[model samples]
Target: MDSLSQPFTFSQRAQKLTGSAIREILKVTARPEIISFAGGLPTPAGFPVEEIHRAFDKVLSEQGRVALQYATTEGYLPLRQWLADQMTAEGDVVSPDEVLLVNGSQQALDMLGKLFIDEGSKVLVESPTYLGALQAFSLYEPSYTSIPTDEQGMLPEYVSSPEAAGARMLYALPNFQNPTGLRLALERRQELVERCAAARIPIIEDDPYGELRYAGERLPSLLSLGRKAGATVVRLGTFSKVLAPGLRLGYIVAPRAIIDKLVQVKQATDLHTSTLTQMAVYEVVRTGFLDKHLPTVRDLYQKQCGYMLDAMQQHFPASAKWTHPEGGMFIWVTLPEHIDATVLLQKAIDKLVAFVPGEPFYAGADVKRNTLRLSFATVPEEKIREGIAILGKLISEA
Candidate 1:
């Protein structure tokens, strides 16, 4: 009788999707007075502004109409070829046909979900995985199986066993993973690929931070290692961290057959990423500018990370623990067992300091309440020290 009062019903898939916790917190952290460590944002200082400006001008001067026109769903040909060449240089052999450019890596996660997930299908993730991955995959509503992880990343034994037999795919960020900021040790990487191969499980190797290493030896990507051993792997990469997020450009490297399917879905989604932007990006990166620019970025990030860690050591309670990341933008903090990170966040915000509570980063029931994630890359050393000081006192008082 009260149809007027009823709202439009949402699809079951849409109903399960929730907003990103970090995104929502960004609104509060936006206050200039607040010293925030909540976001995994890259240092904007590293963005080659003058170079990008020149590239855009050059693109317009050279390929104006073609750059502005609709591009192939598979992506800009030269950029795709450039990616293939770069991969080959990195020792991950692949052809340009194997790479499909997407709007960004975020879209790749959604597309992978479209390709692999079904209702009640089993999906494996690290105990604390990327919140964005959870948000993207949750729309498909898979039964999540959180694999146990250590400071070295996911444990291979649990994921390779018969108990994980029903899982459709394993999603992992083996290099400087979000939230955790921990890398999968080099020794464990090959074992993981071998085990997942034996388990007959396909892998989605999400690697947006592999190139941002500050210290330690560079490791081989799972896509390269897995392919060498004849395992199926879908690799996702993005220029957001290395280049600029505003460009919204990324690519997927997979088998030609799988890439063909993804191209169809991507066409239905956005037709293609901005043709002008793709051409402009190619102009900027074509001359190996990133190779020269990235070292400065690494040095800057290393200095900032050291500053943040030093602050944490000076101020946190004895029971509090945190990860020491060799690279990337985040540091995962674990407070005393009795301390709830969400509650701690409320107190810190009042003191004009903010951090993302780690509970939202988990997919299953055994969520950790005492943990949180901190990003040091975007914050200056002075603010990082000040913010950590305030957050430290708040936790101790609590």
Candidate 2:
């Protein structure tokens, strides 16, 4: 038999893996004419190009040999210390020893799955959560328990249920959640942490967009609250949103014991994230560059989000409802119950606009097909208006 045609044995996990729904849509929307709200991409205009160039220059020039050499799997120390200090400042007292840098929050998610999940392990998650996280954790073949979630976030009362009580872990994206762009209510944050802690369930708090708030006061993170109540909360942070995604830098802050095991798992995976990249990132952020740069990014996103919401209000049907987020790149639209977003997406694509249908974001059978997510992060104000108008027309027709 020809090697290409031969049937090769594959692992059960490999056999079960499916491509990311957003990434597949990105392929169709790759056409220049398509106005895509399908991806979680940050605007390229927000990246600090000159600063990144300067940081790379400084690192390579100042320590060329060391920058190129292999380093410990724990990652660059100064970067770890900086992460620890930032967490401490955020009210979660952390030590450098508790930090482990990974390729991105995506990798951290995968490593967490490897560390904690076994086949049939019950993992709890929001009804509609980050699809990337779903993709990462799904590989472990764990059975997911979809917690009841809403605009204010997951219902804490559900944590007392038998499914949640036996869950091996609970995953959340509390700040400007990807699909819904909803923040967990402040009171629910503490109660959710306390409930899960009492059950001895580890909470995986993935916070990639925590700093992108455009309105309202910033709320305390689950990590901070969990620590106060003696709960096990592991936080995942990334510079992808604030800096640049191309750098592929993210970190995990957990209990020392968890960090120690994740370090071992990562060693067997990639040995370490790129040393040169870590050093360059440290060089850029060490000077408090994000503090200055992020304000401009926020202003631009707020304007773009406004344009989208305004256009939606003018063009969408009266029955359609959508989230009004204080921050983050997405606005989740909920159409009438009879409309299937997947079917609607094909029509939107024909009109040169694209969005992610909300079904795949759910972990269980109660998937809602009337929902879709629109991202305004990379779209210009004019394009956002144009795209929302097109989507609104299609949805109204549907």
What does the lDDT read for residue 36 in candidate 2?
Answer: 94
- Candidate 1 lDDT, tens digit per residue, 321-371? 999999898999988889999998988888999999999989899899999
Checking candidate 2 for backbone clashes, the offending pairs are none
Candidate 2 C-alpha lDDT tens digits along 60-137? 999989999999999999999999998899888999999999999999999999999999999999999999999999
lDDT of each: 0.91, 0.93
Worst 10 residues of 2 by lDDT: 2-11
Q: If scored against the real structure, what TM-score would every candidate get?
A: 0.97, 0.98
Q: State which candidate has the highest TM-score.
A: 2
Highest lDDT against the true fold, candidate: 2
**Model 1 stretches astray by more than 4 angstroms:** 1-7
**Compared to the true structure, candidate 1 yields what TM-score?**
0.97
Candidate 2 clash figure, as a count: 0
Candidate RMSDs in Å, in order, are 1.5, 1.3
